[model samples]
Target: MSTTSPRRLHLNVNILHSGFVPSAWRLAHADPRAFVDVAHYVRVAQIAEAAKFDAVFLADNASIADQIDFRPITALEPTVLLASIAAATSHIGVIGTASTSYNEPYNIARRFATLDHVSGGRAGWNVVTTADLGSARNFGRDAVPVHAERYACADEFTSVVKALWNSWEDDAFVGDKTAGRFIDTSKVHPIEHRGEWFSVAGALNLPRSPQGHPVLIQAGGSADGRDLAARHAEAVFSASQSFDESASYARDLKSRAAAYGRGPNAIRVLPGLTTIIGATEADALRRRDELIDLIPWSYSLTRLAGTLGVPADTLKLDERLPDNLPLPGGGNGNHTFFHATLAQARTHGYTARQLIRALAGGGGHRVIVGTPEQIADDIEHWFNGGAADGFNLMPDALPDGLQDFVDGVVPILRRRGLFRSDYDGSTLREHFGLQRPVNPHARMETPVVAA
Candidate 1:
């Protein structure tokens, strides 16, 4: 028998509106208004916490980027919704997406830092760049910024955010009655950051958060995106349909992180996995079919076209995707989803109709339809094989679908010694087996403040 300890798998349930399936809200049991309901999110989070899942994540959008006429888009501001989730549940970490494109470094830094404090260190920020013209217009831009420019801004934005997070030493706060000093001014230093995109004056107004810094999580799959993740993100939410793809992604990302002087295992890779479960294989297949059948062909086609960055009219339902399709919007469209969607279609020679079915009603993530045992096996294989550190699960439907997994798959994982049966730590960092960041400013005797 091997004496080495078993690898611990992480699981974070993405509290996507309704579910991963666009038609999920139309289900008899689902509430169409759940996207805006704080209670719905709270309840979903509670379920995850009960099962000892590592975290509960929220994907955000600045504008209505989905087929809002037929489905619920990601409407609620993630940090606010996640704050509600944190209040209701005690154990699950709350990670929310906030784009660097529209917001300033200081505000984003302070918002998440405050969230970290409020959640007792269970908050994480999923860094993203706005790639849609709709979102750009929301921020008063007629068009999206170039891809390289966005990533460059993200790198600097992240750097400045980090510097601010570390500006105040851990012991900066010293409330001693005798000394009559609430804080040591010397311990708090200014970041004094000036970059191509942003210029910020000294230290943040607040001290460092409970996790030292809330865990930095990112979700991007392009070359530039990977470099951003490797340089700054502690964990990455990936979109890989197959084990080989995920393995290749993990290897490349870790190597990039290593080049930045971080450990090879520094970044945890968690791919998106949408689950549609049933007691039997046939039942699961039927469930998937039902969900697919519920969605209008028009909705799926438009959504698929959007992912591919092509016009809906460009695709014929029965034909394969056109070869050598250039990057959309003159190569400024969302590169990650574009490539991922194209790969799935090309690999299987799936026509537009078949691709729609394969993507589970036209989204760009891996979908699985199976019994609890079958799902567990897939999860186990990925975790043990180093293809993924864990998964950001998107169930077919909310509450019920998530509840099914907790009841069925979690038990199997525990039995196999692949997942945690209970909470071993309270902070998000602990849940992911990461350490709290040390305040680099502490090492310096004095830090300069920008005038």
Candidate 2:
């Protein structure tokens, strides 16, 4: 082993519609019905592990949206998919998205803890607030809650989850055969959390997870979102279209973290990335055009309208966006993607057709098209250039696209010492080199309000 620790690169494969390309499913080789199939997801996760990736992450939404008619949605519950993934692979970390807004803390706490145990500590929870009026409707609400209140609920929600995770001390499990004892009951405590949003009466039903608590990840970029991440989140999934914007976001978030008595390194920001791979520059361009050509113009228009909160019929493909475009009313929709898409259009002064073509299937994440070597080069440039700490890889097509990334780009990354060649530890936290979180009681001071 080298005495000097290598500069590790964290790569997470994000399973999006066979792959990240908007028309990936429409490809002749792509499976249109794969989204609901558990085995399809498991096979993808297995490929990621074989490539030595840090984890396979699944994004989620609680309700069906307008785009479901045109494209597949992530309809499976993340915990369920991750459990299946855990069974199929032993070393890869499984990260699942769960909306704090719609879920109860106690249930979430127990669910993730069980996942961690089942996966041998290779589980992580991506905390999100399902931000769409459509989701609210499914939950029997007329409208989405405001940003501030949603975050307030998230803050209280995560607190309860953490407390429940710590209810059982490390030594609480004492399976002594001779003594006929299974556990030390006194070591297990109840968390009586009565907060403005939720109340949890007591301890989690399961024992403490192998990694203490599954890693807490957050992915909102609003002001309120950053504050919550600073105080609690270990990793954050972000979206920024340009390098300058990404650096600014990274700097601002890390700087803001200091106010919470946490250091800049306390939180890691990984931006969403969609890559289209080819053998050469010309090949890459051809490949991208192929994917774009597969998208139905009507589907793109409807999706764009919903994102901009505009009526679909009013948006003409050939026309420029009307001046003084309205901001989304009600805190509905995926805020990061909502903002990023608008920013992309505004930056390039794009017409409706241009914008639709550019976004094709990315949904709002940054999209990069290049050869395999070029793809690795772009990732290295961003990682070292302060644009990101790591990337959440969204392949443009399912198994084929991901396979190309793994077989071609992974070796380049290893050769350049940008990524790992083998497993370092069993748990997701260990793979990320993060320390197990110490319980809050050990660090609690009198709660101080933001001035």
Candidate 3:
């Protein structure tokens, strides 16, 4: 609460296959093969970049977590796909998800560092702990680790990555042809790190990146998750359905970051938002219904049951969620989404079928169906009300859904002075108004002892 003018909003479009809805691929205009098409992704990114969006995010899972029979899965590797996007677009940031649970710290560090260079410092890493047993099994584990253990590993993983990124000083490369010196040997240092999770003798293969370190992002809602984010994350993709809940979460996260000696604005909380836009309210509702109608009840039920850790048959389409439903393993495996789904059910008394429609783009995040004016109002409310720094937008369909929002809502935001009308900076850090991190090992002073 600095009582200052509000910070400009930030938005990133999550390009989820064809779209957020399960049946988006079946839309008359959507290409069923878009999920595997690099051109499809590039087209979407170009659209977002043209609109002055801050970034385009791609979420990943090690296994086929979704019901692939009905919908397209998140198939391509994020970093590789983002490289193609980077070559196509100039300003928009490219963020890709990589799990701390399954991947080595060294490889993760090199991958993102390389991407940062390829994108000219417009790369971001969304740190996630793989929660599903399917992903664990794919990585050779029979079961997912307990909540606390996963976070412990993540803590170490992130630390090692940051250390490796700092191994080479920004000025390490002198490249003087007359002296035949390509690098300043004295300026390079090894991070000699050995920890429970990772061990690295560093001095990264590449020099320091343009943005120092690519922006670090996190998406989790459990106590451990929030603590990790407060300690390290520069941005958080949240799952909150209501304004009050989102606002409360923002305050708590900012306070936690402050306690860790970070500024109040250190972490930007961006809740997931699904928008189904139309020229009229009726038109929007009709489109939402059309998408919902295409999704089978069995698919929605099974999906919900998986998150709840209960039998699909146990849930009735017309009945309320069981009051005695137990929290999954003391709140593990998508803790944020499980609780958010429950909150929506209990607060609004939505029957299972109604709940499915309410969460047409799968649940957990908030959904808005309206004309551009109404959508703009909702976005303004969240940004001005301290409920969010911005949003991780998941449009109903790719290209088309994103096109509508960009053409419709973006102009409104620009008119109201709520968003930028043009690109203001070249790097992701500059776009988000984040400071580039200084290399901890670059310049240091030795302590003097008094005798």
Instruction: Show the colliding residue pairs in model 3.
Output: none
lDDT of 2 by residue, 63-148 (tens): 88747666788888999889999999999999999998888998999999999999999999998887787789988999888878
* Range of the 10 consecutive residues with the lowest summed lDDT in candidate 3: 324-333
* Candidate 2 structure, TM-score to reference: 0.94
lDDT of 1 at 427: 97
- Alpha-carbon runs more than 4 Å astray in model 2: 1-4, 330-333, 440-451
TM-score pick, better of 2 and 3? 3
Worst 10 residues of 2 by lDDT: 325-334
lDDT of 3 by residue, 1-451 (tens): 5876547999999999999988999999999999999999999999999999999999999999989989899999999999999999999999999999999888999999999999999999999998898998988998899999999999999989988888888899999999999999787888888988788898688988999999999999989999999999999999998999999999999988998999988988999999999999999999999998888889999998887878899999999888878767556678888988888888899999888889884957788999999999999999999999999999998989999999999999999999998877999998888999988767766889899
Off by over 4 Å in 3: 1-6, 444-451
Model 1 segments more than 4 A misplaced: 1-5, 444-451
Q: For candidate 1, lDDT tens digit of each residue in 1-451?
A: 8985556999999988898999999999889999888999999999999999999999888888988789988888898888888888887999999999999999999999999989999999999998999999998999899999999999999999999889899999999999788999989998888789999996899988999999999999989999999999999999998899999999999999999999977899999999989999999999999999999999999998898888999989999999899988888888877888888998999999999888888578998899999999999999989999999999999989999999999999999998998898899999998978877776655878899
Per-candidate Cα RMSD to the true structure, in Å, reads 4.0, 4.7, 2.8
lDDT score of residue 416 within candidate 2: 93
